[model samples]
Structure formats: structure tokens, C-alpha cells
Target: MGCSACLWLLLSLGCVWGMGRRARETVLGTLGKATMLRIPPELQNLTLHCGEAMWKRDTEDPQRKLVLLKYSGGNYTNFMQGRNRFHKLDFSLEILNTSRQDRQLYEYVVSKASEEEVWQIQLEVYEPVSHPSIQILSRVLANGSCAVTLNCTTERGDNVSYNWASQDLSTSGLCSHNGSLLHLSYSLQDASIACACTASNPISSRVVTFNSSECNYEHGGGAGLRTEQLVLLVVVPIVTVVVIIGVFVVARLAMPRASPEQEHSSLAEDGTLHTIYSQVQRVESPKKDPTTVYAKVMMPMV
Candidate 1:
């Protein structure tokens, strides 16, 4: 009877050893396949939440371990449950032994959850900076025949809408939002105006203004009108006076002069006038010699 009992005990020991080896091989073999690795969704975030539970193991004893809990994303503490619950709990099923081979599996689970959480945080932060920027496209002149365009561009917002308003009474137009640009066109008169653009999202709002100067021709009339009138008044009269003076100077220099003879002829034609003219002509003519003389007495003495 003693021998039989010893034999049964040996057989049982062998069976238990075989089973443990098989379980280790199975787990390791699945890891080697790469495709068979299973990761729990809950363990994805490497960061732990407050009061989150984790399995902790004793550095000296491989079998003795306890649950460690986290109170926040970073804070961790021992899981101190009542004895009744702690004793019945199984650590083997919850905690896998940390080994060089388990690193990939652990990282894979944590990375997925962490990525999702990070994306959510980024989206929340982006909401406030998503407002659009307003740009002055063009403006009309004072003639009231021209139209001006204003553009509103969204910087980071999605599905953005725009509102535009002008302070000028003479201007009237509608605002249309297309993608990232807002367009507005209006007929301009001589008036000062202010334009504003409001960009809105479901969570936030922003506004921008394009204020026109009081002297801006596209808006309305102001002190600029008086300045223009003064320039025209001062310049036009000076130009007209200069042109009149130039015309008088040119006419005086270009007139023809009468000769002295023509003036005398126009006065009268009489015999005394003829005799005076004839005597003057005679005095002005070249004179001729009265007679010629010659002597030949020197040749007879030689």
C-alpha cells in the first residue's frame, strides 16, 4: 500500500510539471506569431487615471503580488481593499509576468489608448483659436458708381459662418460666406463708414473691424470736400490770369510797323513836297569833275 501511494504521488508531480511547461510554451508561442497577440483596450493609455487599479508584484517573490491603484493620471498607490475581498482575488489572471518578451504587448495596448486621449485634448484646445481674419479687398471711389469688396478668411475654424455690417447709410450689401472667405460688395458714396466681420463656431465667436477714415472717399464726404474746393479755387484763377497776360505780350510783339515814306505819302502829295524830295536826292548823288589839266615841259630839258 505504501509503494502504491508513492507511485501515485510521483505520477501526479510529473503531470503538473508537464502542464506548467505546456502553458508557458503556449503563451510564448502565441507571442512569437505576432498576429496572435491580444491587447485589451482599457490598458491602452500608459497614463493611469485616479483610483485606477494595477497589479503589483514582489521583486523577491515571483508568486506574491498585490494590486496597485492610481488616483490620477500620474498618482499611484497600493490597492488596500478589505481582507475578505483581497484574499479571494486572483492575481495570476489579472497580471501577466513582466518579461523582455512582454514589452511589445504592453506597449501596444498603452499606445492606442494614449493616442486617442491626446487627439481629444488637441481638438478641445483648437476651438478657441479657430476664428477667421478679415481683409480689405477693395473700396469704391466717391462717385457712387463703384463697388467695394471685403474678404473674411478663417484661420483654423471649420464650418465657419460670417456676418458683416457697415455704418455708412449710403452703402448697402449682403455678406456671403464661402469656405474660408467671406465676400461683400456694395455701392459707395461720399460717406465715412465702418465694416465689421464676425466669425462664429458652435463653441466660440470672434469679431474684426475695418474702419474707414472720415476723409476716405469711398465712405462719405467730410473735411476733404473743403480742402478740394480750396485747391480748385486758388489754382484756377491764377492759371487764368497767367494765360491772359501771355496773350497780350505775344500780340504786341507780333504787330507790323509803317515806314517813314509811307507815313509822309499818307499825309499829302504837293509840289513843295516834290521839290524838297528832288533837292535831297541831288545832294545824295555822286559829284563829277568840272575839267581835266595836263603838263609836258620836263622831257624837252632832258
Candidate 2:
């Protein structure tokens, strides 16, 4: 018996299923590559009755016809070119430089003395991965530190992965993975350091780097928003309110002191003053009406 797990060999380029008829399985191969799809190599040692064995292919015709092989009567057919060669030494079928057209289901029918057994195989192809790229969420911070976020992506990578690396290929300190499989985050204190991101797939891999020094943290506004800017924006309003309160307290202490008896009294806080006065008046009737006339006096105070 063949190792069930070894029957399928997964490679960076593709896959190959190496097994026999008793344990049938699918075989994966890359395009433009030759592969050996055998039923069971160990079967050669078996002492079973061998009547006749034939190879066949699946067709998409409306009749669901089965296409016979180019080999018949232990001789190669005229239509059988150099692509499909049969090695009479072990009766093995070799398909050379397989193409997309060759990705399909194939069968080998065997006729024995007691019963017949049919072996099947399937082939699949996949495209290789492409060059990857990196994207940073925030490149700079206000305090010269960098809270960096890098995202890696490839053009043709299947289920691609991402990882963060530093100048010496070390840790960038507390990196985290997002719900999105493509993105990664790192927090760096020194903006002068360098970092990189690696993206890979089964077929290929790529790496991209980011220069931390290029991300300068300007005092007012940096290349990207930083965590420290919130403090700067908040401090301005707080300082303004403090200055206004200080000015009010100083003005109140500088006001003048006055007494109530002084003329025009004392000046108000707004610099306005009010005053008060007292007076007396007298009146006399004509001498000719001396008998009915008398001196009259009036007093007025304000």
C-alpha cells in the first residue's frame, strides 16, 4: 500500500498525485510540464490475472462519447504523435509538457479473468504569484516617533500572506494582524529607522521596504495625522481660556478706592460719577398792600 499522504505531493509550482488503482486520487500539475500519472507502481509485484488493459479519455460531446487512446493491440496509432509516449518496458503512459487543454479526467480500464477494475485521475493547473506592494496607513507622528501600518498585496498570489521586518530583519515592536489578512501594523519610536513587509504565496514571494526618515514629523502638520496633534490642538484653547481669566482678575484688582462724602462721590468701575447740592429762596409782597403782604421764605434741597 502507498502512503495516503505521500500520494499527493504539494509543490510551490503545483501538485503531483503518486498512487495506484486500488487507492484512486486526483493529480495536480503545472502547465507546460511533463508528469507521470500511474495507477499503482506496486501493482507490478501483484500476482493477479491480467487479461487486457486499455486507456481512455473523457469527451464533452452531446453523445458523451469515450475517446479511445492512440494505442491499440500493443502498437502506437498513426495519430499518436511524440507527445504521448508509451513505454512498453512497464506499460507506463507519459504525457509531455501538459497544457490547459490536457486538464481533464482520464480513465484506465482493465479486463481481468474474474472481474474488471477502472482507475481514474484528474489534473488541475494554477497561475504563479506576482510582485507584491506595500501601503502605509500613517507614516509619521508628531513626537518624531512613527506609528506605522503597512499593507502588502500581490497581483496573482493565491491566499497571500504578510509579515513586518526591521532594518536588521528584526521585530518592529508589537505588530498586530487585522481582520483583513492583507494588512499589518507596527509602532516605531525612531523615525530614522527602516522597515519592510514581506508577501508570499505557494508559487512566489516578494518584499517591500519603507524608509522611516522620509516621514518627517513637522511641528504644525506632518505628512500624515499623528497621535500627538490632538494634544497640540487641545492645548491652544486651554491656554486662551487661562489668559482671559488672568486678565479679568488683574483688571479687578487695579480698580480705584473712593469715599461716599466726596463731591461727585466716587467713580464707578465704568468711570462715571454723580453729584448732589442744597439751596434756599425768599419772596416779599408790595408796600402798598402792607396790611395783607408779608415776607415769604422757601427752602430747596437736591
Candidate 3:
């Protein structure tokens, strides 16, 4: 029973090794470029005898055979051509004009008499990373240093990621980052503060640099409004109120005025007059009113 157990352990180890040997390898490709799917020498040697080899592609669609070769009488012949764009080489397969749709798993199958072996290759295609650009999102004063928020961007890429690099970050303050946004609080007195952003993908990478000296600390660093804006906010309303008062005083000075005595005199001059009348008889009744009568009249103020 002990001897059988030893044999079983050896068999199990062999099976594990065999499985490891068949593990798929990953290959990266750039969009609109050509990539080679190279077969290892061990699998390439399998074609020396009366062996037949075939390549198959597996994707979201059904599995499809890419190419087939038959070796007989110490010679190889192409049995099938799956696609025109695929070029068969001595020890590898070349795919031209790779696209994102071409990313998938591929199997290289070799058959020799009664034995069959398979190798897998995973292909991933990506667009090359574009040049990155940096922009200052905002700036403010924190304590005595300038706190700035920066943003990095790229025009186009596939599976793109951003990483920032800087020097003497601890001297300024704790630096924090989130994806493409970087926040830093640094002092202007601190020697030149510079930061670099690297945008990368599986196939290509790009980098950009920014300097903190470009920040307009006097203008943007203030937590509140600027002096000019504050002056406008406060002084403008006061000036407007003063202007309105001056206009009212000038209007009052320009108008005509009349005193009570002048107004009363004007009214009396324009009003109707009052007079006293007396009648005397002729000489026949002269004796009765021979004596003259006098009367005094008073006028009322208007």
C-alpha cells in the first residue's frame, strides 16, 4: 500500500507539471498594428514528424479555426486558410491591422499520430496613449502656502491610467491624488516645486510636467474676494447713494420759492375790490339831506 501511495504522488506531480506547461501566455498588441503569435520551440518541434497543426480563435462568438497545416513525407502543406489577413510564418502567426474586436483567446493545437497537444495565447489590443495635458483647476491660500488643485487629461487612449511624481512633497505638505486630479499645498518660498504626470496604457505611455510657480498667488490664492472687488462691492453703493443725494439737493436748489407774504400779496392783487356807495336827493328834498354823511370802509386780507 505504501508503494502504491508513492506512485500516486509522482503521478499527481506529473499531472500538475503538465497543466502548468499548458497555461496560456498573454500577448499585447497595438490597435491598427501587426502582432506575432509565436509558438514555443517545444510546440514548433512537434511538427517535425507526421504531425498536423491548427490554430483556432475563441471570442464572444463561436470558436473558429484560423489556419491548418498538415505535415507528411517530411513536407508541410497548407490545408486551410481561415482569413486572408492572417499570414502564416515558419514558427509563428502574424495578424495584420489588429483592432479592438480582434482581442480574444487563441489555441494552437498540434496532433501527432495518436497524441494531441494544445497551447493557449490570450491577445489584448489597446490604443496607444496620447500626450497628456495639465491644467490648474483651482488655487487658494492655506496657512502660508499655496494650495492648488490640478487636473490631467488625454485626448484619446484605451485603458488609460494616471500617476503623479513630484520632489520634496513632504516639505510642502501632505500630497493627495484621486485619479487624474492632484491636490497639493506648497509654499512659494520653497524651492521650485515641480510635478510630473504620466498617463499610460498596456501598450504605450505619455507624460506631462507642471510647475507651481505659474500660480498667480497674489490674485488666486486669496480665500475671499480681491481688494478691487471688495472696493467695488462697498464703495460703489456708497457712491451711488451720495450721487442720488447730491442730485436731490441740486433739484431742490434749482426750484423757485415763494414766501407767505408774497403769496398773500399776489392773491390780494388778483382778487375783486369792495367799495362804499352813498345816494343824495334832488333840491326838492334838499332840506332833509342837506348835511353830508361820512363812512369808513375796511378791506379783508386775502
The number of the candidate with the highest TM-score is: 3
lDDT ranking, best first: 3, 2, 1
Encode model 1's per-residue lDDT on 1-302: one tens digit a residue: 69978755654443333221211111222212221222233222222321132333233345553333323344334353421112112211222222232322111111122222110100011233355555444545564544555566567653467777654544434433333343444444434456667777654668766555432333222234556777799988999999999999999999987799977765544223222211222334447433233322222211
lDDT of 2 by residue, 1-302 (tens): 45644432222112112223344568765556775666664332121224256556667664574544543345544234576766654555667877777767777655444444567777665444566655555444555444544555666745567766665535455333432122333344433555555666554557665554444432212323454566679977899999999999999999976557553433322243323333323246444333433433332322
Off by over 4 Å in 1: 1-127, 130-133, 139-143, 154-161, 165-183, 201-203, 213-302
> Over the stretch 1-302, how does candidate 3's per-residue lDDT look in tens digits?
69978766654443334332465899999998888887876666554432466666775647455544444445555543443133334446677678887788877776644555678899999999989887666778766678877777898999999988765565333433437888877776776676777899998988777665644632222323456667899999999999999999999999989999999978777666645565556677766855454444566655
Candidate 3: list runs displaced more than 4 Å. 1-21, 63-90, 167-178, 217-302
User: For model 3, which pairs clash?
Assistant: none
Which prediction has more favorable lDDT, 1 or 3? 3
- The ten-residue window of minimal lDDT in model 1 covers 116-125
Which 10-residue span in candidate 3 carries the lowest summed lDDT? 217-226
lDDT of 2 at 105: 75
Q: Which candidate, 1 or 2, would have the higher lDDT against the true structure?
A: 2
Candidate 1 has what TM-score? 0.26
